[model samples]
Target: MKKYTADENRYENMQYRRCGKSGIMLPLISLGLWHNFGDKDNFDNARTILRTAFDNGITHFDLANNYGPPYGSAEKNFEKIFKEDFKHYRDELLISTKAGWDMWPGPYGNFGSRKYLIASLDQSLQRMGLDYVDIFYHHRPDPDTPLEETMGALDQIVRDGKALYIGISQYSAKETSKAAEILREQKTPFLIHQPRYNMMDRWVEEGLLNTLEHEGIGSIVFSPLEQGILTNKYLNGIPEDSRAATEGSYLSESQITTEVVEQVQKLNDIAQSRGQSLAQMAVAWLLKDQRVTSVLVGVSKVSQLEDNIGALENLEFSQNELEEIDRILKKD
Candidate 1:
């Protein structure tokens, strides 16, 4: 395997923000392997994307146990790239994986039970070729399992050195507050919260952000582009090679209605006025709020990563621009 040497000035332009009240600092833009880092994906393209992201100062890489089509293939593939390129720089990276979703067939393989969380992390660490992950998340709330049991598993993982910090994803404000209290009682480092937040999806602002702020939990928002809807790819109708047309993709063609295209076109005008792409403006809008620790972005190509990262160059928004956006999005 050829060794990879990262850019010596990789940190030059990358802005790092404190994760809530924690000592850790994450890049304004983090890479998520939720889309193309799988067995069915091209390994070389995936490797390039990872390399470009890291070179551009994206130190945090997010993954989940059930991310791939076959479940866990993303971790397995990432392990190969990590060992070949990043093993020597482990301390410089923050890798996270979740396990709350369904991962296997047996009753013990899914949910937030102590057995499932523990076993899942063990398997995750093995697949990633790491003794510990920077963060471990309960992918989603499991109403079937006791919150105590699920949180207890996270506390145990930190204590056993299997994970450095604990986080929760797709959790409601009420559920987040409850989980934070439990983790606090255990004295675990409940570092961050991963929520699906974007220009189109403003659910996080509906009290989830307040909850995280109250608990001193940092937030890394996923889908800042709203599954490509906030980008130019959908402006001229979904392309045959686009995610909306791809089978099994979370973004379906039916979801891209004519109204959505019109909205996107109007939003693109705002982006062009700001001298940025629609995607760049979308990511920049999220960063305007200090509560957002980082905006998680997924890209299939290195060019996409570079284009998205350009949002950092100009994050400022005039008062009129903000109001105009609201007017467009809220105009039914």
Candidate 2:
């Protein structure tokens, strides 16, 4: 790739955060290709969203091997943008990709084993047109493979200069602590963890957050709006374009219960008082904690991404407001 300097004036104001104890810095708002950048979607729209995101200082792009509808399409689409508008900004960007999910059939194809992780990452780089990923992840834990083996492969990826750092997503606190020890020995550190957490779904509060903090590993949460449940979009009914209406795997009709809608309404009022949308409020809430390096958000449009970028303007949360919001949530 050759140098094509982006309009630096466009993104000079967004916040940049450090990844835990590592020297690497990630933008406070990162973009995740888990949705929107799919094979079945419009490529031009996807490219616009990607460029708009980068123009707003979203330097980190999160991708996975099986991200697109037919699989690997997201990486391929990203490759197009990389070869075009983003070629020069490669050094300024922090691109990441993950494996550990179903990519191919047979035993060697998927899992947390050394063979699977290594092979999957190499293929991911080819798809994305990159020499190496800034951070490579085990998309999810492979229950069958030993944690030691998975950690070893991740260490080797760093040692081989195939990845700048390593991370695990959705692993338990116990599992994270266990892996931390193994990586420490090789001097290969895990940079971050991705978990599904939002105001509605606070599973990480159970233990994952503390574990990462204790181990000095940063975390970036996904589905911070609980697949848009925390927003007012579902309060009346599922819109035709909603994730639930589209039968998204992560969201379902049953998720939008009457009680859930009522809770979101209450939260919406709180956001109104704070002068922000439910989405912006939700994102700000996540960045309030220092242990969280960024919130990897997904969007379908450049305007939508622009609206989300607005959250950086109002990240402070008063203790009383947080307590009041928690009080409402505790009842459910």
lDDT for residue 242 in candidate 2, whole number 0-100: 86
Tell me the deviation in Å of residue 278 in model 1.
Answer: 0.2
State every prediction's TM-score relative to the real structure. 0.98, 0.96
lDDT of 1 by residue, 1-332 (tens): 25679999999999989999999999999999998998989998999899889898999999999887579999999999999999988999999999988899989988899999999999999999999999999999998899999999999999999999999999999999999999989999999999999888899889999988889999999989988999999999999998899897889999899989999999999999999999999999999999999999999888899999999999999999999999888944
- In model 2, how large is the Cα lDDT of residue 272? 91
lDDT of each: 0.93, 0.87
* Candidate 1: stretches off by over 4 Å: none
Candidate number achieving the greatest TM-score relative to the actual structure = 1
Query: Which pairs clash in the backbone of model 2?
Result: none
Candidate 1: deviation at residue 80, Å?
0.7
List, residue by residue over 1-332, the lDDT tens digit for candidate 2: 33345557756878988877888888889999988787898898888788778777788899999998879999998898889888777898899999988899998988798999999999999999999899999988888888889999999999999999999999999988998999998899689988888787787889999999899898988888788887778878778888887754678888788877877888888999999988899999998988788998998878768878898889999999899889878863
Residue pairs of candidate 1 with colliding backbone atoms: none
